[model samples]
Target: MNATGSVSGAERVLLRLADEAIKMGDDVVLVSPSGPILQHIHPEVRHRECKPIGLNGLRSPVSILKYGASLLRAAIVLLPLMRSSNVLVINNTLASPLAFLFQKRLLWLLHDVLGNDLRGAIGKTASRFFRLVIPVSYAAANPLPTGTAVRVVLNGTPLRESKENFAREGTTSVIGCLAALTPWKGQKTLIKAVAELAGVDFRLEFAGSAFPGDEEYARELRVMAKESPVGEKIHFLGNVDPYMTLQSWDLMVLPSVAPEAMPLSLLEALSMGVPCIATNIGGSLEILRDINGDLVPPSQPHALAERIRELLNDEHRRMVLGEAGRDLVSTKYSLEERTKELYWVVAASTDMAGKVPPRR
Candidate 1:
């Protein structure tokens, strides 16, 4: 997107991707509106903040004019940045009714399950214009017209700097959720489930801020947490560092009601040797299992509460799961390895068209 106010999974991936590109001796430039995400980008990368309008449908004449004006502004802002780069990576179609303008060099990093919704329909149409369509997981690649080129590259997390025993050793067990506070993330369900465990020595913590427009939902969550029977146990610890956050929690839960692409939060937890319990939806099933972790039915407080109780009570199981989780991540999800694969995929595509800048 040309502008973003908060960082989510997509932004995390972009940061890593930019870091890798710069390490490989390419000049990297981040073009977006001034936002919180800029703070995380690599220092070597150039930042070109722009004021392009967000994604919207033009149902009226005034809207169409505004959209046209924004597109013109975006084109103007991007012109200087485009000369030194050949490949353009876009996570969403947010700044565009203009995808075709950069058709030959554009790569669509698909992060949604394109299943007939308006966004999906737009994705289906936009797929035709991109040089390569890179979806984060198989779950995110779909419903496009015939012969659309596609590739699925899973997101990755960095391995811990030290294989420190990052496990929680507190007498009071801590259960945490590490995602932005959005209604669809199902934080309320987690709170309700945590409340069911009366007399259990545990604390439920949420470690993220709301995405820009979702502040109201965050407030609602705080209210619900305060009203919960285990009100004292439910804590809102907003935007803590993921590495430090996961280390303090015995168990992590992702209770998403909506489909996910590939969640980096779970990746970070697994990398830190923390066992995760996520609801079965979207990419959760792809990430967690009974072997390394557990998955419960989405939005079910009883099932959620029961599983939480079992894991909190069984220290041996949590340990085994944690070891297995760390092993799995070390083998399959290292950003170092994924960076090579990403370059291979992007390079392979660019080789066919001779479009990407040479990696010096």
Candidate 2:
């Protein structure tokens, strides 16, 4: 798999696939712009730092130049990886659209829904280009691609086995906000919601880091907390270790102001059998609906708080939803199952001259 170096929702998915591939006794090599954040891979898995491509561009003209230059460097390195392997998998099409253009039978794992407006930091022209070009290019290949050309890989949680000793119950009513402390993540809105839940006894744990040089947002959160009635209830467990953070929470709250393609945090929470309260925007609603928990309208702090309050008030409801979530995850979001399917997707494409093959 060829992944960009930076840690984001997409990269974590690739890491999970690497772990699963190694566990199943397959030869897996994780190629990235750099090393990974979670370094828990088996010795059989190879880690290589491919020549950095698109490492230093932010949707400017310089970005186009850097992107092209980086890919050129990556091409020199990727050929051997592709030659040595039977199938090619990529996180997204940005780096290796050529792989698709050249009919390499690539499996592009899609994290977000693509429209004109949702191209990360890229500008309108580039976004339009990608939206227009990617589908057409993939369709031109041998095994005529389908929606399955882009596999939607969801995050999987580790199930804790039932034990004989009575389990000491941890805090069941936790408001877990796992997004970064950016304005779009709606940290302030969540804090306001907690403040509104003044008399309610609940704990709010913020689990993520601030963007580069955005300590001011952290200060703002502190100030907002101090102003709120439940200010003392909010704790910032800044930049949590993924495993530790998942272990510590009973439920997760995702209140993104901006539309997300898919939130790895929410999926991770669901995997751990933790119910989630998220806004009905982007893929959050699509993924969270009818399985685990409530979906409130975006920017409605009172409504968000109320949904959380309902879960808190009814332990039976919480357990039922959480259990349903676990079952849904087991059936739909198992990492091993997804990767195996992904490999087959790539293998099918490879053998069929990049055409998307019909299901048997």
lDDT (Cα atoms) of all candidates against the true structure: 0.77, 0.62
In every candidate, how many clashes are there?
0, 6
Model 2, residue 22: C-alpha shift (Å): 4.3
Best by lDDT: 1
TM-score of each: 0.88, 0.74
Residue lDDT tens for model 1, 250-281: 88999998778778898888887788899776
Error of 2 at 220 (Å): 5.3
Off by over 4 Å in 2: 1-3, 7-9, 20-26, 51-59, 96-105, 118-155, 161-173, 181-184, 210-229, 241-250, 351-360
TM-score of 2: 0.74
RMSD of each: 3.4, 5.9
lDDT of 1: 0.77
lDDT of 2 by residue, 223-250 (tens): 8887778877888887776545666565
Candidate 1 worst ten-residue window by lDDT: 161-170
Q: Judged by TM-score, which candidate is best?
A: 1
